[model samples]
Target: MSEHVLPQTELEAWGTDVQVVVCETCDWRFVLPAETSLPRCPHCFGTELELLSGEVSELPYVAPPEQAVPFAVSEAQLTGGIETFAKGIPLPPKDLNPAALRARLQAIYLPRWWVDAEVAALWQAEVGFDYEVVSHQERYSDTVGGWQARKVHEGRVRWEPRAGRLRRTYENVMAPALEAEKALRAQFGDYDVTRARPYHVDMVRRAPVRLPDRVPAVAWADAEMALRRRAGDECRQAAKGDHIREYRWQPAYPKRNWTLLLLPAYTTYYLDDEQRPQPVLIHGQTGRVIGMRKASLKRAQRIALILGLMALIIFVLSSISLLAVAVAPPLLVLGGIGLLVGMVLGLSALAPLIVVWRFNRPRRRPQER
Candidate 1:
């Protein structure tokens, strides 16, 4: 790997007295200020965040980001997204409302490996070019009242072996720096990287930048693969082919530089019925919200209790009415109706519990990477 130096001023902004902290539960690490007391991990909301005393140099890349996609989500968009998320839950916890979430929201930046490399490669692939074939078929047509010749067109590809030598510089190639990157994108969706602006010191000073957990040694392979795939596409385009396959490359990188590219996101959490924090992530660009909308068991149980009490009251009134039938014979019909209504009310007490149980039940589903 090629070495790159970070500016002295920017390095100070990252904090000279900074310490590395790793969440014991999620194993996600972040570089934070030395005096900053973090009660919870921003990524997973884990309470056990261990502060590492290792030197910054021990980590793979400590240099500040070269570019960043600034948070574009408006205040209105953020509130609207939270409202939509909350509405989906049947009985959300008290702290899960939009007002509470907005107040606790913290702006943070997630890391991605952005590498610039000069590549020289001997590449081979099968390039395919599209062509059209036309044939005439004899068909009986009701409109013509006689046999007619119809033309049929079919599209096909002709594959040919192609080999070439490429020497090019690819910059800002993206690769996952965190293990949870795939799962994060699957939930929050993609960012518009093209809109990234040059990074400034103020960006890090205001919000925490999650450091890359996957070192350059691991991410380099992914970066090289992306470069090779890009080269293959360009080669096919140069050959005037429609498709390419089985691309293989033997490459040498004369010079390469690895830097972090930060993407904007907001992290905030709401307490569930059990008082455990449930983390919520919002896309900084589009205000897309992704998190567990767990129904509150406490709230559900409260409703059930109220229903049970009402049923008991109805039964007591029915018994009194039934006793009154001795004094007036016409009161017998009212007593029967009261008993029936009490039974229905008693049965309805279980509705909230069943709804909450089904909503919060653990279902078999694909676990996000």
Candidate 2:
């Protein structure tokens, strides 16, 4: 593993009064206001949380964030989004509704590492320039009744070897700050980091900020990869080539600056049929919602009971009609129809339960890290 030690200049004490709390279940650490009372882990709904006390420097990444993306979605939009999400669920749980989810919604800022570095490297590559070649071919045409010459232009590239030393500064190359960032991105997709505004203490004074678990040492590898990609693109531009191949570089970082860029998100939970919390995450900007949609087995059972009772009533009426057939022969047809209808209704009574069972069937989902 590559290790990038933080310089003394990069370490700073926490600016806002906050405490670090970690979820025992998910191992997610968050920085929240000291007075905030958290009943459960926002990410996993785990109730086992431990409050940690330590100096800022003892934390893996101590510097405060420089920028953050604010919640662009309004309350009405959030409510509508949740409503739309609930609409897709079949026999939704009683607690899983727009009002409940919106009530429990908590603002959270996810962490991403923003790195600025001055890189110096020796690079080599084969640069290719586009060229056109003209050629003539013979073609036969029925109208001409003779072989005619056809001209063709073919595009090709001319390769040349080139090498040079590169000294450049790259800024704000973002990398994941949390181990679960991949899962989060898979859930919420990517954010437009360029739209981020300068962060302020008030922006996250009440909201919890998820702290970085993938510290600079582990994140530096991803940063280095991003830097190399930037370096290659610059080299290709410098060579003024349409294509480049076998690009290789040896880079050294003389100066590095590390900072944080927080992205906005919201988390809420609702109880399923089993009374377990099912977390719902919403994108702060786009208002996209993602969560496990569960059907209410209790509701399904109640519907089945009602249907079964109706079927039983129909069967009793059919039995009375059959007995009346002893006196009136015309009642025989009515009694048979009633019996058939009653049987059909009884079979249909199981439909709701079957649908609910299918809807609530367990499936694999990405585990929160």
Candidate 3:
């Protein structure tokens, strides 16, 4: 891997008392206090690691982010999201209610790296321009008993071979800062990154900030791909073509700049049957919730028990009615009614039992990304 250095200005912000560690297994970087013991990488749970011993200049600390999209979701919005999530659960755990979930809300900022690159490359592609062709079709209508000419417009593309040299600079092309960045983006959906404001310490004071784990060297390939895509888009626009295909380029990035960008989110957890924490993530900008929708087996069982008791009571009454029928003919009518009612109640009991079974059915757990 090519070595990349952090700007001198960013290094001055770090205190000498802080220790930076990198996991050898996953290449995850973490910043800790000097006295703290090293912990496994949270993403991959990698144990094998090495600690760095050098001046700040020798370390590969990414510069702190300059701008961030602050949390736009209000407390009311978050509550609404939780309530919506809890609405249809058959038998939700007591701890999974809106109030309980709201109490555990935690703010977090996830990191993404933005890269700027100046590139000089020779590129070639088949550019396609769109055109419309008009054709006439002859059709016979049974009602009219006549042939009619129908005109139809069909869209077509004209392709031409083109070759050119591209010398341009692409600014703030995005790259992942974490291994699961793509999954996170898919979960949260897109946000207006342009709305980000200059980063302020107070904005993230109470929230936990996730530092970048994917270094620039590892992320450079993604950056280059993004740049090439941008170049292809620009090329199509320049050629006055609707599409480009079979595009290839040999490019050299003469200059590159890397900076961190933080995105806001809320993270919390609810315990599952095994008392293991199951995470629920809500988008800070959109209030979108993503997590497992779990049903409580204990709650389902309680409901099933109540229904079973109701069915048993009806069955016992029917048995008593059968004995009463021996006394008189009129009593026989009562016995028959009791039998019918008991059968209905017994059938009704299955509804709750089915609910219990459905709620307790095994399901795939939600994955964290």
Worst 10 residues of 3 by lDDT: 40-49
- Model 3 segments beyond 4 Å from truth? 1-3, 6-63, 328-330, 353-369
Reference-based lDDT, each prediction: 0.81, 0.81, 0.72
lDDT of 1 by residue, 1-369 (tens): 244453232345553456567787886777666676764787778575678656656666566677889989999998888878777677879988988778778888999878889999998899999999999999998998999988999999999999999998998898898878977887778998888887776676656678887877788888888898899999999888999999888999999887678899988888988888888888889898888877888998999899889988988888898899989887788888888888898899899889889887885532121
Q: Model 2, 305-341: lDDT tens per residue?
A: 9988998998999889899987998888988888899
Q: Which candidate do you rate higher for lDDT, 1 or 2? A: 2
TM-score, candidate number 3:
0.81
Per-residue alpha-carbon lDDT of candidate 3 for residues 294-347, written as tens digits (9 for 90 to 100): 777776566667766777776787778778776765766776777787778667
Best by TM-score: 1
TM-score per model over all chains: 0.85, 0.80, 0.81
- Candidate 2 positional error at 135, Å: 8.5
List residue ranges in candidate 2 displaced over 4 A.
Answer: 1-12, 53-59, 127-161, 197-199, 312-324, 353-369
Clash counts for the predictions, in order: 0, 0, 0
User: Which numbered prediction scores highest in lDDT against the true structure?
Assistant: 2
